[model samples]
Target: MDITKGYSIAYKGLKNGTHDFAFKVGGALFEAYGSAEIMGGDCDVEVKLDKSETQLVADVTIRGDVVVACDRCLEECRVPVDFEGRLLVKFSDEVREYDGEILWLLPGEDEVDLAQYIYESIVLSLPYQRVHPEGGCDPEMLRRFRIVSDKEFAEIEDRAGAEPDNTAWGKLAELKERMEAGPQDDEK
Candidate 1:
């Protein structure tokens, strides 16, 4: 059986209560989405659907490990992701905007394919910048990264001081001292 099929609910035939659904997504499912940078792993998805007289409310939760390449070492690392969000589905003769989280569907529509919604929720759960936690990365990789970052920090500090050439500035100071000791250039 297609594992993902369990993630969707046929709200038309449901009773006016709550229904629970679960799905296990793998790399194959992400591949279908086209050009996704997901590694082969299992993720658990739980969806709670509440059927109402006018609309359906779905609360989705995703949790599991995803393998991603380390930004420093370029080595594979497992990143755990967990997040939950809600979606509202409204049935209307004509598409109407209910709210930011609400979606309008045609009255004639029999079922809502929730695959996209679930996928988006999971994707949004990921951190904006996927990086390993401090001290959680490879030792050798950390060493190299430190070297590069240290040099960059030093350059930034120098620029912030507004001395383009430290040595040149020192020489200019010496020249000013000599002029002050001798005849003042401004007096000439």
Candidate 2:
């Protein structure tokens, strides 16, 4: 069976009122989408749907943890996910695109597939900077992928620029100068 099928709800026979649905999102959902950023995940999706003659409005909440590469340590890190959003489902005879806030469906469609929406909500809920807490990362991995402090980076740049008489540095500086001089000067 398709992994994403779990996220689909058949709404054709529902009465025109309100309904509640819950789903468990797992690594399978991320794998189905071929997500590179999400190594694995375990999340809960809650949807409160209010259906009427014309439209369906859903209030969605998702919370869970997903594994991703740590920005500072180059190791698998567990990142928390928490998201809440509203989605409007609108039907149209002509094809319409899902524009983030609204999902368009053809009139003949029997089920609403929420695989993409749930996946996106979870992915978007992740913090921009995914990293292990201070000292939480493996010491060896941290040492291997150590990030230079701003001062150290500045010093390295200065040395790379100032030591023009050094063999390797000098060659790099010469190449930089040649490139900056453009094609005409280099040809001359």
**Which regions of candidate 1 fall more than 4 Å away from where they truly are?**
1-6, 95-100, 135-188
TM-score of each: 0.64, 0.76
Error of 1 at 36 (Å): 3.5
Clashes of each: 0, 0
lDDT of each: 0.71, 0.84
Give the range where candidate 2 is weakest over 10 consecutive residues by summed lDDT.
163-172
Candidate 2 off by > 4 Å: 147-188
Q: How far is each candidate from the true structure, as Cα RMSD in Å?
A: 13.1, 8.7
Candidate 1 local lDDT, 87-185, one digit each (tens): 899887887964648878898876767767766766667666666777677775554445445466455455547555455334544564587699756
